[model samples]
Target: MNKTVNQKAWFLVLPVLILVGFSAVIPLMTVVNYSVQDTFGNNVFFWAGLDWFRDMLESERMWNALGRQLVFSGIILAIEVPLGIFVALNMPKKGFWASFCLVLMSLPLLIPWNVVGTIWQIFGRVDIGLLGYVLAKLGVNYNYTQNVIDAWATVIVMDVWHWTSLVALLAYAGLQSIPDAYYQAAKIDQASRWKVFRFIELPKMAGVLMIAILLRFMDSFMIYTEPFVVTGGGPGNATTFLSIDLVKMALGQFDLGPAAAFSLMYFLVILLISWVFYTVMTNLDKRDGV
Candidate 1:
């Protein structure tokens, strides 16, 4: 006789399914509908077919935004990943300091994205902000609003301050999973600090590092609120990544059809990159017998 399964579990999952349907599926459907059609005032719509998609594809603005986005994400990842790993490697393994450091690291992650933007906005202000004031006192010219390079630097530094903690925390967790015995073994082999890290710690942390990379990449690629709040994609659109461009097209310029198409393509690019990361990570895990 076959054993009975917990078919009743479906009842518990039903609410979550409904919530997802409302939150994700419905909005997604709405976006799809808008992407394929054009609309005017009074809720009137006209069939546009693939016209929007074609236009977004051929648009130089979209390409420029996408290029800027890729560059920003690349810069963020390049700086953050290595810095996070280095910080993690130096954190206390056990004791009060460990707990203290962990809590400190998590504080940045706990702050709201908008709040992070606001905090940094004030932080880099040329008037009363500590950073700006200090830099100016030192005879340094620093103005995010006026200079594109300053705006980009401020955004990247803000991101590093806000989210590098996440990577460090992940790497720290990966470090924790390594048994003390491994360190003892490395010591027995008379391994240098770099040797221990390169041979033992790095291998173990690879999984979490991949996760950190994926998270950082996705977050940086789609980043909007912070930069928007700080720069408003100003200084001649120097920091106008794809999301800002999408907002500009949809709301600023009030071009719905092209905006929707641009958004869909943007979503696909993110999805595709995320898939590649997931595939590489899973394969690495398999190879390492993780």
Candidate 2:
């Protein structure tokens, strides 16, 4: 006789399916509807076909925003990944100091994103902000609002300060998973610090590092509120990444069709990059028998 399958689990999953339908699928379908149609006013929609998508593809403004977004994400990954790995490697392996270090590393990650933005906005102000005041006192030109370089620097630094801790924490967890036997073997072999890291620690942390990269990349690529709160995509659109530009199109200019199309393309780019990363990671795992 055939064993009975647990068909009852569908009942348990039904609520989640309903919730997802309302929260994600419905809204996504609405966006798809808008993306292919244009509206004048009073809820009158005209079929625009692929016009909006074509316009977004050909628009220089969108391309420029895309370029800036890529650069910002690249800079974030470059700084945060290496810095996080370094911090993780140096963290205390055991005891009270380890606990203390872990707590310290976690503090930044716990702060609200908008609050982080607000804090940085004030903190970089030239008037009463300590950082700005000190920089000015030291004869440094530090003004995030008025200058492009200052705006970019402040945004980059703010992002680094806020998110580096996440990378460190993930990397630390990866480090914690390595058995002491590996370190002992390395020590017996008289492995230098670099060799231990290269041949042992790095390989062990590869899984988590991949995770860290993907997380940071996606977050940085979609970054909005922090930079918005801080720079407002100002100084001649120097910090106007894709999200800001999309918001501008949707709300600022009231170009709903273009905005919807832009959003869909944005979603696709993230999906594509994430898929690539996942595929590479899976292949690497298989190669290493992981």
Candidate 3:
């Protein structure tokens, strides 16, 4: 029996498709065009083929930036995931305090990225900022602008403060979805806290945790505004990530062709890594029967 398919849904989605084409596809096409051709003012363009890509691949500056980016992302995931889960596990399950705690946890995520960076910038000044002044009084040699280790620590702490709440909130939501029956059953079985968590909660929260890991990974990998504003990719390029280097090439030095190629490679790396993360997590979930 053949029935007529309803095609009306296409009309509703047409606007969104057109918008995406204009916003994403058009800009990507322009980047591709710029990446393959070199311009010598007066609107004259010469075919450069894959020269820019080859140069970027061989460049030590790009490699250094990539290493820094990878380390930052790895540190963020390691700290934020476990910390967030711990927080969610300790949060109140219900009532007024739950509401208050939820609001408090959301406060950091509500602030603008640049504003967060600016706030930290001021808050870390040794002469005036509360944190720095106190540390100085205690004789702690903490200077993000001068010391490489201090700069890395400050940025890592800043990101953890800003984004850990997001992971906690997601984990909290996952916990909320679990039925009370599971806990009751665990109690009846006289299962230990660790056993219950391993057998029940961990498996249940795996999906959301995977989501949190992926989101944090992608965001940390592509991070720009906060660190740029706070450290300005300084302290002798110790904090310079790929995004900062790309900006220096495209705008600071006006190396459009190379910058475009660099950006495309950046995009591909993020995409590839994200795919790997997704695949590995999905396999783990399947193996665990989650």
- In candidate 2 the C-alpha lDDT for residue 59 amounts to 94
Q: Give each prediction's root-mean-square deviation over alpha carbons.
A: 2.0, 1.5, 1.6
lDDT of 1: 0.92
Judge candidate 3 at residue 105 and give its lDDT: 99
Among all candidates shown, the one with the greatest lDDT: 2
lDDT tens readout by residue for model 3, 112-170: 99999998888888999888788899999999999999889989999999999999999
Give the 10-residue window scoring lowest on summed lDDT in candidate 1. 281-290
Per-prediction TM-score: 0.94, 0.96, 0.96
Question: For residues 256-285, what per-residue lDDT tens digits would candidate 2 score against the true structure?
Answer: 999999999999999999999899899978
Better lDDT candidate (1, 2)? 2
Relative to the true structure, candidate 1 reaches a TM of: 0.94
lDDT of each: 0.92, 0.94, 0.94
- lDDT, model 3: 0.94
lDDT of 1 by residue, 230-262 (tens): 998988899998999899989998888888888
